[model samples]
Target: MAQVILTFFVAYGIVVGGALCGGIGAFLTHKPPLLSMELLADQLKIFGIVGALGGSFDSFLQIEKILIGNFSPVVKQLAMIVVAFLGAHIGTICVQWLVQVRS
Candidate 1:
């Protein structure tokens, strides 16, 4: 539990700190950096919180375990879909611009 929380914070720091460094570099070189560091900081906080919640959800799930594959299929399916959507959305939103820039 504590380990997961610590990892989330550390990961968030790596993300925001790297973005800040890149933003500062761009500012020094007179480039726009695409997005402001402040905006990125706000986004990182949101992203980290959501990520932690999603990752820790299973641990906190308060459902009784069933025998012979008798879990709540609807909830399981919904969770899977939600997680997939989140993964795709994050990948697309985060990397779309970078991909375009490289082309």
Candidate 2:
């Protein structure tokens, strides 16, 4: 339970932080900050997931366990991954709303 929540927050933070930093970089380079943020948010989703999961080794392990007829850990891992993805997505939406770049 705690681990799941932590994973979600970690993923969320990664997206939000990455987007904000990217926006700053764009601003420094005389580009559009909001557009850069939106683009970075999209690009950072997979990174957020992988980061929250602490890299891909555990996920691969879960897959192996699933193939070996043990489903509980794999199911929990899947749930965590889903929650992490939701967190990253929501963070992107938040950036979009902040920038008012999307309808």
Candidate 3:
């Protein structure tokens, strides 16, 4: 129970961190501050929603078992966090591309 809650907290933190890094990269690359902030918020929201979905399902667990062939809770949590972060980062990029296209 506690562990499950902790896993979600840690995963969310990592996803937010990744989003912050993405925002910083955008700013450093000369993107407008407003756009960078929007990207950051969008990424965080996307990651959180996706993470929640994944947590609610067992698909990631099955994938984790297939890829790692073990059932270590810690490893599963870590993998979830990584995948969540990556999904958020990729989502941010896609949003940026869409914004550029629309402009």
Query: lDDT tens digits, residues 1-103, model 1?
Result: 4544444444455445645666688789987665554445445554544553455465234233444455785455345434444443443345334423431
What are the TM-scores, per candidate, against the unseen true structure? 0.36, 0.91, 0.40
Candidate 3 lDDT by residue in tens digits, 1-103: 5545554555555455555676678878997754665556574765564564465456455555655656675466666665556545555555555445333
lDDT per residue, candidate 2, 13-77, as tens digits? 99999999999999999999999999899899999989999996877688778778999998988
List per-prediction Cα lDDT, in the order shown: 0.49, 0.90, 0.57
What stretches of model 3 exceed 4 Å from their correct place?
Answer: 49-103
Candidate with top lDDT is 2
What global local distance difference test value does model 2 have?
0.90
Cα lDDT over the full model 1:
0.49
Best by TM-score: 2
Error of 3 at 13 (Å): 1.2
Pitting candidate 2 against candidate 3, the one with the higher TM-score is 2
Model 1: lowest-lDDT 10 consecutive positions: 94-103
TM-score of 1: 0.36
Model 1 per-residue lDDT at 10: 49
